[model samples]
Target: MGKREQAREEAAFMRGDVGVDGAATEEKQDAAEVERGKAREALLRGKAYLGREFLTWLLWRSESGEPVAAFEKTGLSVLFLGRVVLKGISGDVTELSARGAMAPYSEQVRQGMDRGLLVHQARLMLTHGEKAYEVTLDAEFLDIRAAKLPALMSEEDDSRTGERLYLAEQLSAMITTLVEAFIAVRAGRTWSKQVVPAMKEWMRGEEGTRKQTALQRAASARKR
Candidate 1:
């Protein structure tokens, strides 16, 4: 769980938002609902920076080609594609987006990462077995705004609906597992000792990129 959520739940517990035998009261339930509501609100309103952090971590992990989990025997892999929305924590150009096929790997997106911008929204292509599921993932809600399910082998309409539902459940399980992996690292001692350092190093590569670019320019000029 994220710090903000942990804090909120703790606050509720502190305030005794519990009923008989320490059961969650209406207020506590409302608090939980509030979180989901905020996620939905992110669609039209403010971004969820906490969730954005998770997405940013996922982006790095994905690019590093690290596997999050071994889902069943089929194996699940994630790739970000098409578009990525990034938002600055607190600075100029608070929000920016890159689109098209190569957007995820563009320099503008990397610069945004260098500027401490976390992912606000992104398109994910999850490959399970031999099929792929495409979805627009919202950072705050972890909601699937839209999805293109993998092709179904079912022939009848009802069978196709069941297949679709199964695919949706599979996607949800994949997301949950991915989030759990991030949470494990984040909640463990390795977060500050290892993960953060690794992420910072990933973010600190603009200098290298600039040097490479300069060398390319020099080589081009020499060719001229």
Candidate 2:
């Protein structure tokens, strides 16, 4: 076979789109593509919890009144800001959003979390060492949206551009590291034995607060 013809056959083989003896491959290729797609769908559906849990855990940590995490011996600070979105795969109310300056620690966010919804997306203010970043984080895709980086220290055009790039890369790296840190802890036995239990305790506290708020509202209603 000539080089071009041989190349075409090899490419087709690599794609699993054809076989020897020139048998028709349309239906077979379509079946294979459908099977691959199904596998991908199943994988994503089953594994989506990891992202949700990581964001939820981060939000829980944020409520401790201070940034309370360290990575590779460096202190890191995370604050949920602007808007927080909580969602579950299946529910009567599948999604909820809390907004504004104090939205991160608001009663609605906590109550939603207590009800077993995970954080699907949230705005985050992150500090790594001395640098700060603001980003809206989407859990399922790990997307860093609407990012704000620290101010540049350079004035010259080339130098300023370089610094900006550096800051952007740093922002991305910090987020990736944070995700890796969460995954490590999640995979360890500590997640079940210690972490999850602690989170449940936090949730219980929220429930109590909600009950108290309900009582206050009822009392005020009666007075009115």
Candidate 3:
């Protein structure tokens, strides 16, 4: 072959190699994108699941008239969820509650979460978190840190303290969302229906023990 012919052949070979590399790179990028989407979906699903369980717990507790215990038990989880909603919607916490018990938030972001939670609280109530916990949540006074839902369903590891703090803020926001739902339900029920189950059921375990103690005391007194 002549010199020009050989040069042409070499160029063609290089072009073919480049074509194969490009195709592989594209495939890799597509696969990565797919994985990311799946991860995002999983995260959302997990949050929803956690939210539901918390709501149920709250419901049961409220019905039983143990709101304070319910609050303490699910406090952290609510904080996490609140933070997520806040972060996702870019809303405020103070508007939900003037209580300084929440993580700090910017004026703009607090407003966003407040608005978003007010709109989304009903769906969230029907979907997740404990029943009473949701009731305790209020959109106007929502805490961004109070909804710190566990990331187990869609664990998003925050590599930094700042990220964790952000998560805390979202959790608080979620709690406010629940509170809003509770108020709506309360108003609908005319605040007369038992927010919890029969008070007897709520006091069952402790009251039972107390009764037993009283009976024993009477027996001892008779013997004396």
User: Which regions of candidate 3 fall more than 4 Å away from where they truly are?
Assistant: 1-162, 196-201, 204-224
**Tens-digit lDDT track of model 1 for 1-224:** 99998787778788988643557876434543454455445533534675687788887776644455677755666667778999876888889999866566566787788787888899887767677778888877678899988778999999999999999998888887776666556555577798887777667763253223323322332343
**Could you tell me the lDDT of residue 11 within candidate 3?**
72
TM-score of 2: 0.68
Ranking by TM-score: 1, 2, 3
Q: Report the lDDT tens digits of candidate 3 across residue range 1-224.
A: 99998686667667663353334222344644564455344434554433432343343232222222223235322221122122223443422322221211223333443343222122121112432122233222222223323333334555555565654555455554444444344334333455333322323332232223323322432343
The lDDT of each candidate is: 0.71, 0.71, 0.34
Number of the predicted model whose TM-score against the real structure is largest: 1
lDDT of 2 at 191: 77
Q: Encode model 2's per-residue lDDT on 1-224: one tens digit a residue.
A: 89999898888877878867555466644644564454345434645666788889887776653555665578777777668888887768778988876675666777787787888888887867777778888877667778988888999999999999988887887776777666656656577799998887776673343323323322432343
Displacement of residue 100 (Cα, Å) in model 3 is 27
